[model samples]
Each structure stands twice: as C-alpha cells, then as structure tokens.
Target: MAWAAWLVLWALWALRGWSCLRCDPGSMQLLQELTGPYLSRQLRGDPGLRERLEALLQRSIEGLAELPIGLPSYMGVIDEKTMGEAAAHFRRAVTRIMENDYKDGQLFNEMMWSLQALRESFTSLMARFQREVFCPNKCGHMVHQFIDCRACRTEIYSCNRGLYCGERRLQVQEDDDLILDCALSWHRASYGAKSYRFYRARGNSEEVMVTSPDAFLLKKEVTANDSGRYRCEMLNTKGWVCSELRFQVTVTPLPGNSTPLPMPPLLGPLTLPPSSHPTPLGGPGDWTVWIIIGSSAGLVLLLIGGCAWLFRRQREVPKEDQDSPGGQLNT
Candidate 1:
C-alpha cells in the first residue's frame, strides 16, 4: 500500500507533464508547427514567400482544439468557454505572426509586437491545458450522466439545494449500474481529506453498500434488491463523519414493462445517525483498475533506484581495505 501511494504520486506527477501539451494524437505535428521554430531566421526572401508561409500556418491553427477527453483528476470541471477562448487565441497568434512578418523572417525578434502577442496567446492556452484539458479526476456531474462524465472533473456548487449540499433523484432502468458521489465538500477543507461510506436502508437495518475505504459509491448490475434509500457520508481521516449526501434511486423496469417499481425510502441527511455499523470498503472498488497504471511507475522507480545503488556501490572502497591507502592493498 505504501508502494501504491508512492506510485500514485509518481503517475500523478507524470500526468502533470503529459497534460501540459493537449494536442490530439493527430494534431501533434500541427502543434509543433505553431509552437516550433517555423519562424526561423532563414526563409526565402521572395515577395510571395511570407504570404504562402502565413497561409500554411493559418491552416494549422484553424481547428486547433478538438474536444479533449475530460476526466476530473483534479476534481473540477473544465471551463469550456475559457477553453474555446484559448483556441481562439491560438488562432489569433499565428495570424499576428503572419501579419507582422518581414522580409528578414525575424518574426520573433524583440521589437516584433506580434511575437509578444503570440507568446501571450500560447501562455493562456497552456494554462487552460493544465486546468481543463488533461485534468484526471472524476467529478459528480448532473448533466447527461452518460455523456458529460467523460470531460474534466467539476465541483458541484450551483443547481443543488444548498451551496455545498445537493440531492439527485435518479430513475435508472434495471440492470443499470447505480453510481453515487460521496465526495461532497461542505467547506473549503473537507473535499479531498475525507473518505466516503455508502449505505442502502433495509427494513430495520441499513446494509453497507460501500464503506470508508473507497471514495466512490457504486453498486453494479443493480436490480430491484438494490433499490432503496441511499445515504453517502464523508468521514475525516480520524474516522469521524464530516459530510453527507443523500440519493433517491428509483429503479424503473426494462423496456416493454409499463408499471414502475416502488420508490425507495425517503432521502436521508448527509450526516450520520447516532448508531451505525462500519464495514471495510469492499471489492477493491473500481478504482483499482486505474491504480494498475501506477505499478508501471513503481517498476520504473525501482529500476532507477537499483541502478543508483549499484553505481554508488561501485564507487565505494571495499570495507576490507579500510587500512589500505587509496583503497588499494599495498603491492
């Protein structure tokens, strides 16, 4: 588990760098053209040459930003409007470069106003890339649940009941997975520092669907048995409940069935009741699938550490030669 945490840290670090550049696989070369030294000191001084070059560059930045696969790794939604603005600036920069070009091809020279403009544009685009483009965390979104979840993670602040509180009533068909979010932040400090526990109220007892070890609340292949009042709580590291979210799940029948099943018990408070049973977060959770990526980082770190140790060992003098000068036995 310690290794796992370290691996998680490493993958997260690596992801930070990978996310800085968000060009699509098909657009890498185009990105390089925009950011690279296409504006070199050397180019044909012919009158039509710069225009042709500008035209080519303009084509490169026209449809620059494709929809990036948004996953909420940093735990917030991408700013689409800002992202669009970035792509716009990306287009504007090259246009500026072309407009400011000279016979000398010195587009990036200090006196070039367009050079600064281009730089500023790319800087803005780069910031968007970090915050929205490659962010890795998943968020609890209220939009079209199937399509909207893929984009960057987003924190829910509006459209819910209270500032930090929200309730979602879902009418999911049978056999559909029931997924709920327990990572609600009631205050500034309560979001990431807590673990989530999920429960479904039975007759007199509430069965533990998911416990504190997992951050996600999920019951896969949910059937009629799974339909019940669901409560999710966020607990601090010390195992004290800190925040809660209520979910009302109505499991509708599959196609061809007209009548709807009974609704689950009423939604409960986000906070826990006085008496409760705590259970281990079971099934390794779906998050284990993602942690597999961290193992590769672990192996790479181990290899680097092993190599460093061997190199340092080779540089050391043998302990048996402690008395010998220059780490060599006389004669």
Candidate 2:
C-alpha cells in the first residue's frame, strides 16, 4: 500500500511538479527516505556509481512527464475508460522509453531498476498505486492528468498531446510570468530529440530562448520585451522539426502605482508561478464591491445641523414669549 501511494506521488510530482499540490510534504519525505535505503544496498562500494545513479534518477523522473500512460493505441480509435486505465497509462510510459532511439533506451537500461527483479518491483508498486490511489481518485476522463482528490492550486496542467499540454495563448501585464512545455521537453522521446529551441517573435524580429533556467520549463517574467508571438519546435535525430508548439504572448504594461492585474494559471505549464510570481488571489466566481467612504460623514453632518437648528430655535424663544400663551416656545 505504501509503495503504491509512492508511485502515484512520484509520477504526479514528476509530471506536474509541486506547484499543483495542496497536501502535506510527507510524500516527498517518504520518497527520499525510501530511496536512500534502497539505493544504499546497491551503492555500497562504488562511490562514483552513486553519482551516476543519482543523475539517472533525476533524468528518469524528469522524463516521466512526457511518456504517455500505456502503449500506443491499436489504431486511431480510442479506448473507453475502464478498470485497467492505470495499466495502460504505465504501459504507454514504458513503451515510449523503450521505443525511443538507442540513447534513450540505453539510459533507461543503465538505471538501477533495469534488472528484471527491480523492474518487476517497480511494476508491482505501480499496480498497487492503481488499485489504492488511481481508481479511487478518478474525478474526470483525464486519468493521466487528474490524480487523487485533485490536490491542486486554483488550476492544473499536464501532458495531453504531442506536447505535454497541447497549445496555448497568453496576454498578461508586466511582472507576469509564463511556462511552456512540449514533446521534446522530455529528456527522451520516440524520436532521438535531444534538445528543443524556443523562439519568440516581435514584428519582424525574433529571439531564441537559450539561457532560460531550464530547457523543459520556461520561467520568464514578461516585460515589454516579452510581448509577441512565440514558438517551440521539437527536432528529431535528423535535425528537423518533428513537433511544433506555438503561443502568442502579449505583455501589457501595468499602470503606474496600480496593483498588477492577477493572471490565473494557463492551460499548460504557462500558469506556473511562485518562481516568477505567485498565483491567483481570487475565488470560483467573479464579484464586485461598491464602497461609499464619505457617506457616514454626510449623515453625521446632517444630524449635527438638525441638533443646532433645534438649539437655535430654543434660544430664539425669549423668557417673555414663554410667559405669553400666543408666543409659546412650542412655536
């Protein structure tokens, strides 16, 4: 049961990252604890082996997002949602890795779990994940994306198409940030796509995204410079584009001294914030507030005037008038 839950957590985290989670931190801690004990068994003598294994682990985790759940479909036809979607999902992931070019499969084979026994162990863990975690948490048709009680921020993003999350478009104010993901965003794909080039267009000019913090993830705090059309191309082993993901990012200037407009999560990774900027400070529905600030002051002044008028009228009535019936203070 614990291993199954770990599979769900590791896969979800590897795909969505921590931004979408709202649960406790124990999942990661449990994973780290488990990983150390397990790796220690095989990593006792060879000091260099640990480093290589760590790199393999990191790469494998990152690659998990792109590998679709289960193997390729039989035809263009899609399968109905059934009890074994989890198996299909994982089958796709494994098949994608193995089907990739030689280098991709080689890296996977080098991983500690490549051995038949360890591979079966990994498979067993995933099976438990399906029964305990996957089936019970099905919220919608998107089994690969929607995992568990939908523990996400205000939104979620995942791998759906050739790219992890399909296409996207964005228009946000200055100081806003963006994220873009694609097929080549993974470390390994069916094609020997080693790297991707990101490009943005402004009028006739364009700039390639080279120095971004990460190749798979694009964390850019949009400025005036960011406003324009954007595209990312996944190149195959032949150095030609195999897949293309495009976006039109428009960065509007934030008015001086005004609160920067809130930007909700985008369809895909582009919604990622907290690294560039925090996410939404809104609710499920829109709302409006009409504040009347000085109305209370106006009411106080009216009351004071009424009291002053009564006091003046009392003063106007002389003592002699009070003594006379016709000139009574009541008048």
**Candidate topping TM-score:** 1
Q: Give residue 133's lDDT in candidate 2 (0 to 100).
A: 36
> How many Å off is the CA of 257 in candidate 2?
3.5
Against the true structure, candidate 1 reaches a TM-score of: 0.28
Off by over 4 Å in 2: 1-167, 184-193, 211-219, 255-331
For residues 255-292, could you state the per-residue lDDT of candidate 2 as single tens digits?
77466797775566654345464334563222222123
Off by over 4 Å in 1: 1-166, 185-192, 257-331
Task: Give the Å error, residue 174, model 2.
Answer: 1.5
Query: Tens-digit lDDT track for model 1 on 54-159?
Result: 4544443332223244333222223444445544554555455545544342432422444345445645554654453332223332121111222334433322
lDDT assessment of candidate 1: 0.49
TM-score of every candidate relative to the true structure: 0.28, 0.27
Whole-model lDDT values for every prediction? 0.49, 0.45
Worst 10 residues of 1 by lDDT: 141-150
